[model samples]
Target chain A: MDSRRLFSGSFSLKNIHPSVLITAVFLVAYPSFATDFFIFQIGAYSLILGTIALSLMMLAGYGGMVSLAQLTVAGLAAYLMAILGDNSMGVMGLGWPWWLTVIVSVLGAALFSTFIGAVSVRTEGIYTIMITLAVAVAFFYFVRQNYVLFNGFTGFAGVEPPTLFGVYWRDPVPFYYLSLVVAVGFFAAVSYCARSTFGLGLQAIRDNPRRMRALGYNVTLHRIVAYFFSGIVAGVGGVLLVWFNGRVSPGTVGVDVAIDILVIAVVGGMRHPIGPFLGAIAFVLLENFAIDLIDRERFNMVIGAAFLLVVLFSPDGLLGLWNRVRDRLRFRGNAQLSAERVNKDDPASSGSLEKS
Target chain B: MRNFIERHTFWAIVLLLVVVLFLWMIFAVWPDWLVEAFGRKKTFVNTLLNGVTLGGLYFLVASGFTLIFGLMRNVNLAHGSMYLLGAYIGYEVADRTGNWFLGLAVAFLAVAISGVLLQVLIFRRMANDDLRQTLVTIGISIIAADAMLAIWTGTTYQFSPPDWLFGAADLPIISVIKSSGAAVYIKYPVFRLVVLAIAVAVGIGLWIFLNRTRIGMMIRAGVNDREMLAATGVNVQLVFVLVFAIGAGLAGFAGVIGGTALSVAPGEDIRYLLASLVVVIVGGLGSITGAAVGALIIGLAEQFGLAYFPTYGVVLTFLIMVVVLAVRPQGLMGGRG
Candidate 1:
């Protein structure tokens, strides 16, 4: 392996994809060109969702653990923020400083995630889904039932984002930028970690835990630690989410929202960090405009159908679909040329091709 | 039982003590102190009975799930939708014809046919991939949930049992002796008792079908090793469809029964699905007896928790699952595989 830093297997600045740079620039310049609705609802909202989905992607994609409690963990953070910070509900607010509240909330979520991981890591593969789902549902019900702590069904509303540096962060452009920073930070961290020793070992454990155990790795510990990291990512997203919504409720952590996170992560493709954002954008767009095509209540059906199609045809999601199309195009154009060269250039396609 | 006692005398003694205490609590009139400490004897007994009866409903739903999982390694997440669908169909039939039994029969047959369709069209295409099966089922659940909402709307529907099953039946258990020297017995809903009886009958029938019958042997063999069963010239695909049909039918049957006992609505699917998932997890997968035991434990825990601690009732069920996962990841009766 090369000593140089790699971003999604790229070794140098010149090796970076043009599309990635364009997307980055476009996201940065988005607030200036777009209206507040596009800036906040479409832009920031997608980024927040994408960040949460990215945490799930990191777990399911790299760590081989499909946890449905990512949203629950995010919800916990949001709830904590509402409790610790100013709230209009006259419930559990301690009026703590924003920085302190955010830090504590993130750590609390991470610890909670770690506990969930500890409980669920005992089971393998499919059972992981069942366990995490059970936990998510349990938390949702707990929050809904407990009035003394979680304010019961109504939850906390009027949770305002702090005014920092003489600017209100919750405003459209500012919130969009805040979400973008968090999103980009998490995206970079996940991508960088994918090549790091821990990430490689995590992937190794995912592929064959028994073999990794024989090789003297603490497979359970590694997976649990991965959950902690993913929790932090989700926790930040949760804080941003509460700020974005201006409230936190039991509905925020409901099973439907949890499933939506899974759908986003899956529909984006779980293979890479960027897949989550791609998926989140598509999901957000669909969710926003679904009313135009059909009744708002039937949006779930449309998304479910789309998800089924993607799962059936391309198990890897839209990112995988793109890769396949690109590979096919390259393969067709180079039929008379060296097929081996193309294969060497893209290992993902080569492995898929061989499997087929 | 003798072998178990011989192997674990301590556990046997503990079990005996618990049983004796339970029997004493039921048979003997609670002293004043006991009554004050534990609230009303009627409430206590009712909660226990409700828990056990509710367990019957859970068993009906979960047995099918474990059966499919045991045979196909597929977790049909859309199963809840099937339950809701059956309830709606059963509700329609019963309402239109004014025959509850006919409604139950129609719901079973209709859901079974749909199950057959699913087996042929979707599952047959991806026979080996469990993940894909799970994803497909999730997608199906989403679509089915929406479609059902579109058709039935979101109103809660309750089934009206016949007059005989409508009222309560007097139980032999003594609740209290009045000052006038009359013994008052506990009265419970007759329909709930009937549900319990039906569950017991189904459990025994399933056990007999699985253990005594020849096809049961084939199913057991297939659950252990599908390729080997196929190599032995068994019509594996036919067996798959048959099991799917039966399993799906059981869920539908339970839907009608449960709808009568409880109510049918949009989100009932998720509630029952969660129940089945937790029950199966605690009971051990691919085992009928495990489902029964798990359902009993979960049902009792849920009812007791609701009675004693209403706020954290869901947590009680969840804690059982977590504890089971921690202590025995394979579940209590799950094979060592």
Candidate 2:
């Protein structure tokens, strides 16, 4: 699942994989039969978080830059939407249409992420993590303090979705579908991009920056572009997130959420495009239902234990475990040998990070 | 612009200090655009002392963090969690027994044990995998923070020093020109001064241990080349284990001190974690000197910001980090990025 031929020319969805087909069918039918709790709590929240995690996965997985600021980007988008679009909070509402607000928000986040990447790209591994994290924490404090720009700690509270097509998009089914469409579109885009020439080149750089530079590629530019892509994806998630909750606040982009996104991506398996959504579904379910079994206050403990276990046993995440199980069920020795060979051959594909 | 500075390291470092000094003077002037409350000279002295004390606490925390990073290359994100753990432990102990020294010992020992477990159980397996180690530490931190909440609840807690150390001490920073005579005074918390003394002792002892001992040399070597150290017949695992525990234990120690100075609460773990991070970045990673210098800079900026610009206190710490990273990604003393 992690490996592909360097220059594969085949891109067809005609013969859809069973797993993909099954998931799509379930998502399409989810809103009709599911209860409001399941639709909003499980469906909408999971997809929104999944999309944000997916953005992180794209950068850390493909571009080999682990950033702890995707949530900041999303929060920024949410804040922009609240300010630029009409909202009940009555704090600097520009009364712009939702579509224009979204476009502007996403583009603005893209620019923001690109700038963040530019500042950080010169540093390797741990420095990137520290810089991005510092920036994110800084943004959180800035938002909490700057009342004029971010409405202070208590941010905009009413950010209802635009009623396009005479259907109040905040309705459970409509919102669920909206989240699904955006998530699926980004998932597909990331999947396709992973196979494209630019993606392969990006992966090559991730593996050996020196070699790629020798071969005449602007490694820094590629890394920045990857961050920008993730920024746009995260921005979309942010807009959808505000619509789902109908609010935006400093808490929305706090350090907890920032790390939560990282945990989701890591737990899902950053190697594949679908890993983040799966991770998000697991996370959302845990967040939503685990409180019944455990104390509500200790929820982070459960997530932390689960994250540690997942990382310890399978650094490739849940998908890696699934692949391992599948391989074991197949002609055991051959599958094991082939898997080992693939891992050995392409370190970047396996996400075995090597500091530049 | 950043590349130009990186290429000219000495000049850039000087330029950074000059800018910081200039900003300090400008802010000290209390221009009309700034807040209007801080005209008293005594207040500036109080703020400066607070900065030093605060910096001392940061050094206690970040020293361990940078040492672990230097030796094992593992980013212990749980360092702050350990701090919180220590604070809580000290609170419970001191609250029960009413003995400050006993509470300090227990806090250190308990956090040390957990640090050892963290090394042996989690970070050991991830060997040289910084990202995975980071993820594991994050998980550990989350678990610890939640567990603290479950036990301590959401309310903030504090462990005051012994009654003897509670009074304020007069620092002779300013002189009064009354008709009686000139008397110097800036009354400061005796407990804070005690904490400062302890922090200084730890810093000096740590510096000596690293530079004047065989084990310290081994650790320095390990940070530079773990493989080489292993190849030369050193038990690198033992070194890693020892360093991890020391780093974690230091954070725990800082926790109780910080708790007494400023109450420990639910979110203080992340707060200290972020503070130490800023300390390491500005000071440069791995070196004791770097950690000390960085902590003082952060402490001063933070205290001054809080006194003059309450809203922008935390923002100043982050701003320092960004400026440092832009000019020198390797940090003030970091030889390697």
Candidate 3:
């Protein structure tokens, strides 16, 4: 019945400790797997998606802004990299170095997100969703039609993944490990930020914007920073996605996929950092299997059904369910312990306690 | 007032138009030279026509978008999927009945039923929660789109109504200036004209419904204040369900018209969904007039951009959206909600 231990457990859940278990499991098991495609395609893809969803979770869960344009930012980065790099066939090709190209792409994504966030953050609730959705659509069509930069419907191709450390990084194993490292790093960064004063400030703002404004917290600045941070995660994921696929197209960053990220975040539970990974795993696995079993066209049906069911049954997502089960078990154990204590302290009181 | 004309905003637009006209004149007067300088003018015009037709279809889609957003205060992302559903239903009906009118009627009704079902089953449950409602509708949209794709096998289906309505028409309006040596030909599809008519009719009907009917009064009240309306014993839940159904029904009707005008294929739903969203955003959510105005502006932008700036045509709608949002966050009409 010690209040100190209860607080400690809750604090640990909010900190980087739980991630240690997840990271240990991944690192230990990943090397033993021999399938290159499994490591690179499935594992890498999930990590990349997880990173993108993590960014969304920060925005929606923390800032109360459910953006439908996060994927657009990621796509924009991928497209910018392809268009500005040496391999581009576009008219505005810069032929820049890979490092410079990646930096510019990420910056471009951040800037784009800032512009969207600036306008969108002004509104709250569904209006914000619509605004971001509009921006995403506009970007999608713009890329699909503009051949000079986006290369029209075909999009930019032959954008090679960078070779580093005398290794072909495009290989599934390397890419998987790369994604794993990046995901872990980004997860840690977000986890750290969430415990920081700024994260607490953002959460406070989300809870009551008027009150936060009264407290002299620059609400808009906090939101913009969150957006910039979210954009960075999405931008990184986009870079990895292009490298993994070896191509960038309008289809890669369309509205459907943008919504899919939101779905992943919500399904995994927006309450924790691990939620994105859980959601991403479930989404990617469901998508892969659904596509395999059903007609390719009907695969989205399964996803849609899952989305509806998850939202209706569990507003808190998978993490919420896990916490609920854990809480129930703990409550039962505490009850049994209390009964034993009662029996030892006051035997007569036990009969009354049992009746009660 | 005189100085206003010389401002950068005014001059910049004038300069743009001048440049565009200069380019047009160069292409028209120096055919062979212009062909060498730029791409072919005929091809450019054809692409422009394509853009216009595409924009027209988008207008239809966006019109429905504006209507739904204006009344319900619900951003139904599934509007696009409803559009796709309408197209598939129309295609199936047409294949079976061999009658375009019948197919359209059946498709419209089928889509309306789906819309009502959605309102009752899903959106009704999400009355107060906007985010959850959006998520759920998006889920429904995806499901509808996937189901359509599954049934249709994701293959592009061609739906030509009639021979006369297939391509552009040579009207008497063009014949009057035949001897003037001017390109006065305005080639347009009959189906597009039908779309225009339907849009106008629906617009009128919506206006009347809101202004004249008892149910419309209840809907307007609900839009203004759901609790107030419910307190007044207006059956707010029923009103919400009806509003959603009507919104979805309009989307479906737009889909049938759009499909006939354009090709119905996989991924078309998302494209139209985006377009419709833009329409509502620029037009201001929850205002029919705003949606119409937004649709027209977007339609014309797409048309002209495709005609002149073929490469940047798709970006035109988005650019307008950005500009509109930047300049007027409440949209042009300033919705009550």
Candidate 4:
């Protein structure tokens, strides 16, 4: 019976949430009914931003390191991609093959992120925000000022995605599917890792780094490695982002954009893997449509207010709100069953149940 | 000083040499070869003066940040918004009332009131949750930034200081000798010198406040251990509110002064915020002296870099930060960490 329960517990069809299934179906069929603008601008853009925010989520949620330089990492990849691959900037475009450029750019970003991690991990707790922020701002100013490598003020433009397998990757449908595939892949990867030994150790470290170190875990190395992995995620997102915009500019890696990535991750939820995507969808939609609903200038105020409310009321974000509401309904429906379920699920409470 | 030299013999020697060289650069008349090697004496002195004055402005902004962070453990990301709001408010008040001093007074009071409201409303509700507090501040900053933009378009604003504060004053430093062999002194902006004087005044004021006053002692104790301070019946919340008010007020005050020296524009908030962040990181969080040192180093690096290397100026400031972070992760004067 125990084996059977283990087999049917998580992966069973019935275990899948109805909402998740519906969203998956809708995403797959989105291009069929939606206009090109909606599919590309809203859907693909959200997925790209979500993937980037997910990297931040991985660090802040599980690793307890809230890096503002994640966007800077992504921007480095984007700039590298622009430099190595085709670009109309006539700057440093080496015109390497697209595949090679993507690989190198992602690795470069990971290495850079790892370096940032190594530097920041020397300090602890709240110092992470200040250190990473300094790095991000420094990179922004450096790129804007350095003309030889970064092309200075006017960044690279017209960096297009490669045509592969008889399909233009930048086309609305293809890009949407591309972004969706990458986003879902990362989402699943994060979910799986969250249960892995490494992730469990990370969470343990987050809860108590000194204790983890006392228990013989290399806390600093684990954190730096997490940064490397998150860098990969952010790098891929950056590649997709640059492709989405067909350009890479200093504005892409500016301080405001760096903070915006943090906002998206925090607003969505830092606890779950899906939170970034959910947050990204809301953000992208608000960005696109808020101008119509409110004054174009007031959009940041609206989003800021929304973000403030979320932080104040639901620290866990929309997902937390959903869980709270669901729990309330479940509690109202059958209080006894809910209490029994908690007793059954939680090992700490099982002792009382046994005594009873 | 002997203890420091014993502890960090190499650094102490380096510091001593740097001071000697700096004094020589400032007071010693540059020979023809020296001028040829390092460019004009006028440019070098001007760069040094600009760096110091800029450091003064940075100290004003960062001291408050370090104070608030040291006491409450809250990273007020909205601190920059307060600075910009102060600058804008000061500009308006000074322009309308034609009294720059009144503008400064009102800006400080107004921003201090807002800081109090933020403490009572937001920070108090979410005590002990640093990340959440930071997020809320970011949210507030976003809203505040947008609201300000809506009110004060994108135009850059500069403060017209009192007429007495206008024009450059001749410094004692000799810039060059004329063909007739007359020594020519270097001239610098009067407002910038006043700014530097005010910064030094605030620094001494803060030092005396922290060391000589009972309320300052309470703040210091609170920074070390809030729980213990509260347990001692010190009214911890009141201390936090007071520190936040002073910290926020200083930022606003700096905004008006800095705007007068430089220019107030849309992106000035982010610039000052970055400067404060870097200053605190290099100086050591929560230490006024650290903020001063860090600001001076950063300001000097930026100006010297700009004067010497046209393109890689930002990198010089960044390199100082990286080197400091690598050498002392706790910052130069940071202790409580």
Interface RMSD of each: 3.7, 2.1, 9.8, 8.1
How do all the candidates rank in terms of lDDT, highest first?
Answer: 4, 1, 2, 3
Of 1 and 4, the candidate ranking higher by TM-score:
1
Q: List the residue pairs that clash in candidate 2.
A: none
TM-score against truth, every candidate = 0.97, 0.91, 0.84, 0.95
Best of the two (1, 4) by DockQ: 1
Angstrom error of the Cα, residue B238, model 2: value is: 1.9
Q: Model 4, residue A210: what's the lDDT?
A: 86
Give me the runs in candidate 2 sitting further than 4 Å from their true place. A1-14, A332-349, A353-356, B1-38, B175-184
Please list the residue runs of candidate 1 whose C-alpha ends up more than 4 Å from where it truly belongs after superposition: A1-12, A335-356
User: Residue B84: error of model 1 in Å?
Assistant: 1.0
CA lDDT of every candidate: 0.89, 0.85, 0.75, 0.89
- For every candidate, what share of the true interface contacts is present? 0.69, 0.66, 0.69, 0.76
lDDT of 4 by residue, B112-166 (tens): 9899999998899988878788888988988889889999999999789899998
Off by over 4 Å in 3: A1-19, A22-25, A88-95, A288-297, A335-356, B1-59, B160-187
TM-score of chain B of each: 0.98, 0.88, 0.80, 0.98
Q: Calculate model 2's interface RMSD in Å.
A: 2.1
Residue pairs of candidate 1 with colliding backbone atoms: none
**Local error of candidate 2 at A167, Å?**
1.4
